[model samples]
Target: MPPNTTSLIQPLDQGIIRTAKAHYRTQVMRKMLQAINDGTSIINYAKSIDILKALYMLKRAWFLVSPATIENCFRKAGFPVIDKTSNVNEMQMVLDVSEFGEAIQEEDFEAFVDCDKEAECFGNLTDDEICDSVKLNRQGMADLEEEDEEEAGISYESIPGVSHKDALMHLSMVRKYLEENFTEYNSYYDIEEMIEKNALINRTQSKITDFFK
Candidate 1:
């Protein structure tokens, strides 16, 4: 499939990603508010967000997406539910951006929800500015070693800068940590636990905060 077609497929463009983005922005906004409340500059927190931390927030936001929401996304893409237990309107196939506005409560949420406004924001940048902001490697790997040579170079021995045994041991430790923390209760009584514990905590916090407001 072409890139455009693939992007338009069942789940990718089916409002799932937009919802996740909104959730992520909401978290960022919350952090900004917290920094303000603490008499600290929001720029510090924004600039200090490393890629790993950003990815963690995104993953957590995605984890909050409900099964029903995902099913609605599939149905929006014209895929009929297999069980046929619910009725979905054909007219409501695609979701509107405004539908996710509730996820973000900041004043700039409207600007974030506006697709044209976002495009306009980025469209003002010059070609050089855009290129400098983005890194692109267009060179082909023509001089790369052949598959046979690559396979022949495989080694498990320790080197000056790297030790394969230590690497494997570190990976094993990470696996153990994840097994104990994240995936430990993933399968309860042979049935997969859909909602994560952290997500439940977040929902509870959100509710408590909203109740007092």
Candidate 2:
């Protein structure tokens, strides 16, 4: 790769990384919206996103990156391609600016994706900093658990779990609403199947608990 030519020739730089970032940002925005809906402070919700939650979000974001997007990225990077159908629009749809209303603009999304363009993945660390990082990694799990517990003490409010029966009722209501409103209601079958599987698992667990009691 020539100097500053990586953006032109690199498959990742072409679209893959941008798509993943857009998906991740969409997830973050949705969570922020949920926090607002639930009356939680945005700062508190942001702080609550630990490494584990972030990893899960990133995992989903990468999983959502279509194979077509990867192929499009390679094609854009000067690679030979058979299918001429560009999946750029598919990537663009991943971050729906309309879904966020006036709170987020198209320019804001573009800026967010490009903000870390010049960021270095690896950086030089001082000897003390390196040693501290090693120490932190060695005891990371225990330290994290203690920190979470302390944080939970200050901010966590326990919400009661929904009963299986109530969950089933709500699921049925959703199914009914979709069936009545949508001509293409076949998608509800997948959701219904998932709920049924979960209900079965819960019932089995309840039986085992009853046996022990």
Candidate 3:
């Protein structure tokens, strides 16, 4: 059965989720080749994949939908055919798509992101877990220091004027929850990209995992 256009709007489209997962791996390679740029890329990559997988799982539709489906949808809608592939560091493979393929371009965000639909849950976790996950959110520094004994049990609401970085991380977590559980997802780049491009949570991947649990 052909997929429904409305179904494509789900928070994390299976197709994109698959692409993002691959993208994360590619990024890991890129960072490694760059003389091991830093200690945080690995963490970001892991969180990103977690995010991609979580979102993809929500779709419950893997390779079931193809890039061609999206292309056809665009062609029929009069959008220009933009051929591209995953963007890594400097080295990227560019493939032209005349025969229906998947090459998630940055511009794709314009069409795929339905602000209303973009707000899906990526991680359907409990409030306590959500609060704990905040520590992992990139706040422009490594989450290496000891948690203040008193601040450990606080919820997002309890905190006042959390730093912009913390807000971004918490929101990322919230977005993950909404994407995984809700019916809409509007982000083109996975939460990982959001973290790297605009971050405040600079903690280890293991820390992020331990935190939520």
Best candidate, lDDT: 2
Regions more than 4 Å wrong, model 1? 6-9, 83-107, 113-213
Measured against the true structure, the TM-scores of the candidates, in listed sequence, are: 0.44, 0.67, 0.22
Q: What are the per-residue Cα lDDT tens digits for candidate 2 across 153-186?
A: 8524465777777877898999789878888987
Answer with 1 or 2, whichever has the higher TM-score. Answer: 2
Root-mean-square deviation (CA) per prediction: 17.9, 5.1, 19.3
What is the alpha-carbon lDDT for the whole of candidate 1?
0.57
Model 3 Cα lDDT, one tens digit per residue, 82-163: 7534222211121212222233443353233332445554446899888777766654233422353245665445667645
Ranking by TM-score: 2, 1, 3
lDDT of each: 0.57, 0.82, 0.46
Pairwise lDDT winner, candidates 1 and 2: 2
- Candidate 1 worst ten-residue window by lDDT: 136-145
Query: What RMSD does model 2 have?
Result: 5.1
